[model samples]
Target: MSAWLRRLRPGRRTWLRLGRDAAILLVVYAAVSLWQTRHLASGSAPALAAHAIDGSPVSLDALHGRPVLVMFWGTWCPICRTELSTLQALSRDWAVVTVAMDSGDAAKIRAFMRERHLDFTVIADPQGAMSRRWGVVAVPAGFVIGPAGQIRFRLVGLTSSWGLRARLWLARGGF
Candidate 1:
């Protein structure tokens, strides 16, 4: 074997240390995630029935037969902006309903949606009343509602599209 290759190989002890570190990091990440979502809504989701910015009616109760992704976000939130595409993509395969928490009036939200080319159903919560009922104090909060109308997962902050997809799939399976 070449000297460089031999030098690049990690020893058994090094591998063990790396594994320990990874485990610790995972624990820390999980703890933080739990802490961040401590105040989020749980149990049965709050009643959400409103008109989308596009004039279509939206209601969480109507989507009870299938898992639904309910997201609370704002146009001013950069993290929420980054997740727009993810939410839009998920809407194609699953039911997605978003609350624009204090984003703006219906006209402004409609403009933002047009600019981003997003077709996801968005209900404007200009006064944040809907978000308050959902216990969402932060932007970019997400909930995976099971087919039985229970909240299966509460996610705070940014989350990967695949992670959300997995949660939706799990919810569908009655998890």
Candidate 2:
């Protein structure tokens, strides 16, 4: 083989190595995501009935005819902060009920919401009782509950607005 053809062999090998590395990385990511959400609620969602920080009644059962996004987040979680805007936007068009997992008392959460100009309904889980009940071990956990009250999807960590919107749409029987 000529020198030019011989040099091309290493380039082909490099591409193969890059592809293998990418595949491995993707597998690792899938494994970690699965492990992180292993204990999360599934099938029929747990009963959630509580008063919002504004003293309004918020019940998952009330939203039984439509898909609802139930999010577990915290004021102290930086990643959750980044997702707050996405949640606020989603709340405008969909049912979004967020639990402030160990964030603080109702007053503190209200203040945080006010500072962020966020109007999404928040249920303060100061003692993490709600989080524990939902099997949420970390912040930024999201669950899409279908109209029949079944959990349609569960996501952990930071999720894009489009990603969340798609999940809610899917839960609503949208293709």
Candidate 3:
């Protein structure tokens, strides 16, 4: 074997290594994208419904005159817990609604709320019908709906404080 060839590690060719890494990354990316897109397409607003923690039915009318933050979450999701806390802290100035995808178990949802000490209005969507309506395949998804009933902003994952602030600023109608 040539000295140069002997010097090369068995599988250390740059092009080959890059191609393999790229392929793996592309596959993972495609899978996540496909999952998110499918969930998005399957979910829509107005098709799901839920009752508040107090057993009162929550409707769009409740938010008719206000900008609403729709947060979809579950007790099992760590990110949901972190995001929920962040949201609750910043949401004092805004009307926020939470939908628990726990499916019919008001008890579980309530326990989660109590444990987290979250004070926002929480509705139970035990069947995931509401989740589907909101295109929430992943936990910790959020939607900011304007007073006009249109989606002003949508966040699909763990959001930074800066990002949340930016959205809030935009909602307040700034440049």
TM-score top scorer: 1
After superposing all C-alphas onto the true structure, candidate 2 shows an RMSD in angstroms of 2.7
TM-score quality measure for candidate 1: 0.92
Give candidate 3's TM-score. 0.69
- Give each prediction's root-mean-square deviation over alpha carbons: 1.9, 2.7, 6.6
Report the number of backbone clashes for model 3.
Answer: 4
For 55-120, candidate 3 gives per-residue lDDT tens digits of 877776666756667778887778887787777876687777888886458877778778878777
For residues 52-150, write the lDDT of model 1, one tens digit per residue: 999999998888799999999999999999999999999999999999999999999999999999999999999999999888999899999999999
Instruction: State model 1's lDDT.
Output: 0.95
Residue pairs that clash (backbone atoms under 3 angstroms), model 3: 43-132, 44-133, 103-126, 104-126
Tens-digit lDDT track of model 2 for 24-121: 99999999989999989899999999999999999998899999999999999999999999998999999999999998899999999999999999
Worst 10 residues of 2 by lDDT: 4-13
Judged by lDDT against the true structure, how good is candidate 2?
0.95
Q: Residue 85 lDDT in model 2? A: 93
Candidate 1 — which residues are off by over 4 angstroms? 1-7
Q: In model 3, which runs have C-alpha deviations exceeding 4 angstroms?
A: 1-49
Q: What is the lDDT of residue 169 in candidate 2?
A: 97
- Give Cα-based local distance difference scores for all models: 0.95, 0.95, 0.72
